[model samples]
Target: MSALKLAIVGGASTYTPELIDGFARLRDTLPIGELVLIDPAADRLELIAALARRIFARQGHHATVTTTTDTTTGVHDADAVLLQLRVGGQAARDKDETWPLECGCVGQETTGAGGLAKALRTVPVVLDIAERVRAANPHAWIVDFTNPVGIVTRALQSAGHKAVGLCNVAIGFQRKFATHLGVDPELVRLDHVGLNHLTWERGVTLLDTPDATTGTEVLPRLLTEHGQAIAADLHLPLPVIQRLGVVPSYYLRYFYQHDQVVKELQDKGSRAAEVAAIEKQLLELYADPALDTKPELLGQRGGAFYSEAAVQLIASLLGTDHRTTVQVVNTRNDGILPFLPDDAVIEVPATVDATGVRPLPQRPLEPLYAGLIASVTAYEHLALDAALHGGRDRVFDALLAHPLIGQIDLADHLTDRLLAHNRHHLNWA
Candidate 1:
């Protein structure tokens, strides 16, 4: 077998150490022969590279680690490229996460108006990098570890690039469920469905495990056994879980209790500001020269289990693993959920192997869930149009279509603010 060459775009992120730790620890899963860290931020890259080398050395791994500013050069011979880039950096994120609160909407990186702004700024940049990667190495699989994953992954697939989107949300749930059930995580399978960030864990099945005494429909047992704990994790009332018989991803709180979330966001301030401070401290620690391993503070920066999720995805996709694995990923719906359009991207359990990602069959959702999915899918359609084509009207239309920004007046407010805050990114605007 050929040695695995992995190139990480945006390798300068403070989160890079988390991934590096995984690479060193899970060397058996992915024998990375040559690892390339690609970034334009030269100073950040320097600090990250030094730390990556130290981590590898400490772990006694011999992966040839390298760094570069040129995307084409860094990805030339790589078999897989992971994208975790932010187009305008945290300054843009701070703007995205704060401006929506001005309209009394929940400000977040991957939902509603802020997410639309991020998509408009990010999709184009990601596509450009994918094109460059294709030019250099046609066979390289692009794994997107970026936010607004559903939209970005759809754009890549629609353009015919070989890419899949990764998020740790599903894996985090799996681990939590496994811990609660006292079983190995691999034994637990999630009937995870919906569009990226907007998803629910409707079913939990344990595969031929001795501890799976409750059988495939263990969702109710989970609710009955740990409803309060699960509800607490999602910041939802226990009755909601008992009523719905489904565990909503934490992102659902924005839709389920929009007003509450908006008020909470207003009071707590922007998550971006918190993460910016964390990143600053992390960079200081990275430059410490004495420090090597990933620090605890990195967990507070979000994206828990990100490296494990990415590694499993890459290992499964590259044919390194013998067994086909079911992992949650963002890919085209293709009727996976009957209610959504074929082109709309959704996050769901997918079977991975050398062939490609195939979303497993999803049970029909209740009208309540299906209606929301349909409405959001429509908004995503408009969102992608605006992200790709660019215009004020398109932006307004997308926001107007969103459930969270349904009012025309609010949509208009957000559109102007989005265009104003992101004019440098949206050239046509």
Candidate 2:
């Protein structure tokens, strides 16, 4: 069998080592022959190249290492491409975070108005990369790790490429809950279904175990029977969990911001400081040697949280495993939300094997939640149309779908901003 060739794009310095180690561990099953590293930053790419080479050398893996600032060269002939690109870094992220907050809207980088802004900035880049990937290696599977994943994945799918957006938040919560419950992660199966950055842990099950029970049945019992002691026993950071609270998988803070999560996002909260420090360090890491050595974490429990969901997809494609877990993947909506634009990009349960990914049909979301996702999907469509069609009306449509911007002012605001900020890119007739 020919060796698998993997391409890593963007923040290659931070994400490459973990992927190198991930593939290294899979040598027995899926041996890699090449690691193609792509990043616009030459120095960061060089350091990553050195680390990958050293790691492979130490592990005695003969994975050939290649580095490039050029996308075409790096992605050419690749079997699987893992992309983690960010447009403008923290400064851009800060804008995404602060701008919406200023608008009295939910200040999130991955959803709503902020997400629309990010999609506007990032969709063009993603499409260009997808085009290159298609031209270079039409057979390659693009595993996108970019934010606004739902929107980006939709764009790639629209452009007609095999692609899936990957995120770690849901998986991290599953692992954390499993650990607290003293269950093996692989044994503790969960049903995490929703869009990117917003998900609910629908259920958790112990697969094929003799004493298996439904999460709904088991969880309430666990919480009632042993809430306080369980918190003490597990030493969990979520003290609220000691009081029978079910932690919704992603953006727990936003949902509980008025209560339990208020502290987590506050200045005194560990999470807020953690995010701040990491952002600061990332800004200076390129110039300073000290931050380069600082470990990079992709999930809640450090590197473990960022395990390649792509590997599961690859394994499924090869049919090497009987079962695998993946989160936030999109497929045809066969009823997860009956009214939410049946074609909307929804995160949900997927079963994969040699045949392909089969998104499990799920119960329809309640009217309110379904409507929220529908509204967001509307903006998603308009954003893509604006990017591909480059019309002023499409930009207005994108803003119109947003709840924060009413139809009355949508065109005016979009026009003023489009003229002022996106003048060169906007198409006016």
**What lDDT tens digits, residue by residue, belong to model 2 across residues 226-289?**
5565455334444666442443544534534423333332333333235556644544543443
TM-score of 2: 0.79
Task: Write one digit per residue (lDDT tens) for candidate 1, span 284-348.
Answer: 99998888799899999888888888888999899887558788999888988877889889999
What is candidate 1's TM-score against the reference?
0.97
lDDT at position 374, candidate 1: 92
In terms of lDDT, the best-performing candidate is 1
Per-model lDDT? 0.90, 0.63
Give Cα distance to truth, residue 68, candidate 1, Å.
0.9
Query: Candidate 2, which ten residues in sequence have the lowest lDDT sum?
Result: 258-267
Off by more than 4 A, model 2: 11-13, 209-217, 222-247, 252-304, 318-328, 334-336, 391-393, 404-429
